[model samples]
Target: MKMKKLLISIVILVLLGIASIYIPIPGYMVITPGEMLNTKEMIQVDQGTKSKGDYYITSFEQGPANAISYLFSFTGIIKVEPMPPLDEQKMDVEKGKADLENSKLSAMTAAIRKAGKDVKYEHKGWEVLKDDTKYGIKKGDLLQAIDGISLKSSEEFFLPDLIKYYEKKKVGDTVTYQILRGEETLEVKTKLVEQNGQKIDDLNLRLSVKQKAEFQSPVKVNFKKLDLGGPSAGLMMTLDILDELLPEDLTKGNKIAGTGTISADGKVGIIGGENYKVLSTIDTGVKVFFCPKENAKLAQETVKKYDIKVKVVPVATLDEAVEYLRNMK
Candidate 1:
């Protein structure tokens, strides 16, 4: 009878463990340091733009976590964040990837233009790239406005700017969108909905860049990462493109890493997680890490806190980075 009780207890304990692992928790996500990926392994520039040396971009892995997994974080140094409901998170993830692809194209345009070559852009209307059945927004319709806000098409509207306006909006507000279908523009209004612990757009639409770039002499670039999202990789990607176009290598025989948002004007904008990136450099075989001028303080603090051997170089523009590398003895 004692052995029978012992076996039953073991079965019960196993079931309990399984339940703990599968149970979902509310309002939290797990964020951990991701790997330092080398850009050379993933980026392909046309032979006209190909250069020498390696560059790395850093990322932090983040996703939804269960109660048991969240609790396990206390045992180590993983970060837990109270995210928007699960459905909202899913939508944001989808939107983030689309925005990232647009940003990468913008980065390529900036890099090729910076090489003193002529670049051309084509205006592709906000063609229905993503179909949302709820708002009667069909595939192939061109988006023209949102809630009376006219989206500019100078370079075929910055898609993220339009998306940000909606994402920051109140959870239950109604939004009116103007879309063009079959040569006629129409007003379509939709309301956001919250249910089952999630709130998502009633007019769930996926939009992308309508602007395609053409460069004289054609220095085409392709950036591929299945799991990568966001525009943080912009600066390194721009730099990599520029490096390949020039005869000299900017990496200068040392491993380099950086994170920043790149603008079409060649400016390096601030990005999040500079502290975490600084910490990532320790024993990672990197000698120099470049960051935006705005993130210099945080990078310095993290470096000093951990006594990392890497040098933190702050640059404001692509030209500054190139000149610094050129003059380096």
Candidate 2:
């Protein structure tokens, strides 16, 4: 009788522990390593398309987790969100994200066009809309600053810089911004708030910045929607597009995976979930994983932590990535 009781108790505890991972704490979100999307297959470049080697985009699978997985997240192997992510903060989360995705595809198209032909991609700033926009920011205005810092015209790309400033701020804080409408720059201020312990942008306006791409030999690039949001895939998309547009096989017959947000000038910006993406890339038989130089320390740490056998290459710009792949032997 005593042995049977002990076994039953153990079983009960085990089941309860397993159940903990899925338990939804109100307002909290879960983040886990997501799978690899062989993005090359998803993108169709109009001119020349060839399957030389694999080029992939990786994302982190996010959702509620079990107790075991929850505890493991603390080891830095996985991430958990304390707040509703930016894309999900609004009711039109999918719509907002889709618009952003379109911008990324546009950016990629511009990058490739500039490499192969003469082209310039231009976007002044994200237009501010009144509907559902937080912080009382009016419509038809351009966001030019955050926290009183001006996103000067001389600054490279406003989107990435705009994102960087907002991310540095926490909930319950006050944020001030400079908006541009025509020739006037006006200051707007708002208070920050938290959703499930994650700080959200005070201004929740869906941004579809006005962009114009100029190219003589325009490449009509179409990206298949895989329900993935975020600009992290920009670099890979640019490289893959270049691979197709250029005669030389950029992959050099080896699988390559990368994560970064690309600017019009081809500068690669930092991205989240590099470690998670790298881990998934490792499983995909990729010979090289490109990481943004801006996150050099994290990339180096991830490589050192896992003692990753796969070559981890750090790149600063789209041209740098192209040059490295071009020289691959």
Candidate 3:
């Protein structure tokens, strides 16, 4: 009887262990190391050159935490955080897609301009910068018109006209906005409010609406649609495009990987999850990693913490990145 009782206890423990693997912890997310992708295979430029070495982009995996992952979060192997609201998560997914599209365009424009080619841009529409308004205007909505006035004109004149229209109205005024949300077109009504002791004007409008850039360049650049989203790959994508445009190889025959958002004017912006990204580079044979200047300290710390062999280089602009590669031995 004693032996039978011991066997039953062992069976119960095994069942509980198995159940833990599938059980999910609510309101929590887990982040883990993701893959390193070669940018050469992801981006293609027509009539572009090739590089002897490869440029890679690193990413992190994040999702709802399982029971095991929730427990492992205490050990520092993974990260666990409160999951964002479902509505916020949906909006983030949309914004991530938009950011990725803008990143590709910025990468192409920056590379082409760097190659001494002409590139011009027009403001397509206004992108919603905030969703705090009560007019049903959510973040990521594209505002095409205000009070029946189209904001799609020349970038120089659009803001002036928009400001002029708003100047005629006082606080507590009602205005209609024509916006595009995915495949649906909706008109939203919002009340004008005073900002900084002044009625809402172009300056106030600019706070909530950012002009979307549409580039026209002589050189055509296209990216293979991947399951990836977000602007963190912008810097690496720009470098890869430049490598294909210039005669000299940017990689210097060494494997390079990086993360940072690139602007149309070549500025590099900070990105999140630098520590996890550093871990992703381990065992990947990446010789150097470039990140935004702001993230450099944290990235270096992570590298040191993990004892990674990769060098962390911080850059403020696309030009700085290019210059660094040019001077690499």
Best by lDDT: 3
- Tens digits of per-residue lDDT for model 1 on 1-329? 99999999999999999888767666677776678878887788878444455788877777677876677677443667677766656665776676567567767877888777777654444555556655666767776777766653523243344445756777778888788788898998777664423343466433432333343436677666746876678788887888877777777777778887776657676666777666677788887788988789988887886688988999977788778777765
**Tens-digit lDDT track for model 2 on 129-194?**
343454455667776767665544421333555556656876667777687777997877666665
Total clashes in model 1, counting residue pairs 3 or more apart in sequence or in different chains: 2
| Model 1 residue 17 distance off true place after TM-score fit, in angstroms | 6.4
| 242 Cα displacement, candidate 3 (Å) | 0.9
* Model 2 / residue 231 / CA error / Å: 1.0
Cα deviation in Å at residue 23, candidate 2?
3.7
lDDT of 3 by residue, 259-293 (tens): 99886778887677888887899987899999988
Clashing pairs in 1: 50-244, 51-244
Candidate order by decreasing lDDT: 3, 1, 2
Cα deviation of 234 in candidate 1 (Å)? 1.4
- Which stretches in model 2 have alpha-carbon errors above 4 Å? 1-22, 25-27, 85-88, 91-99, 102-106, 129-133, 144-176, 180-185, 190-201, 204-217
Go through the candidates in order and give the C-alpha RMSD of each one to the true structure: 5.6, 4.8, 8.1
TM-score of every prediction relative to native: 0.68, 0.76, 0.75
Give the winner by TM-score.
2
What is the Cα root-mean-square deviation between model 1 and the actual structure? 5.6
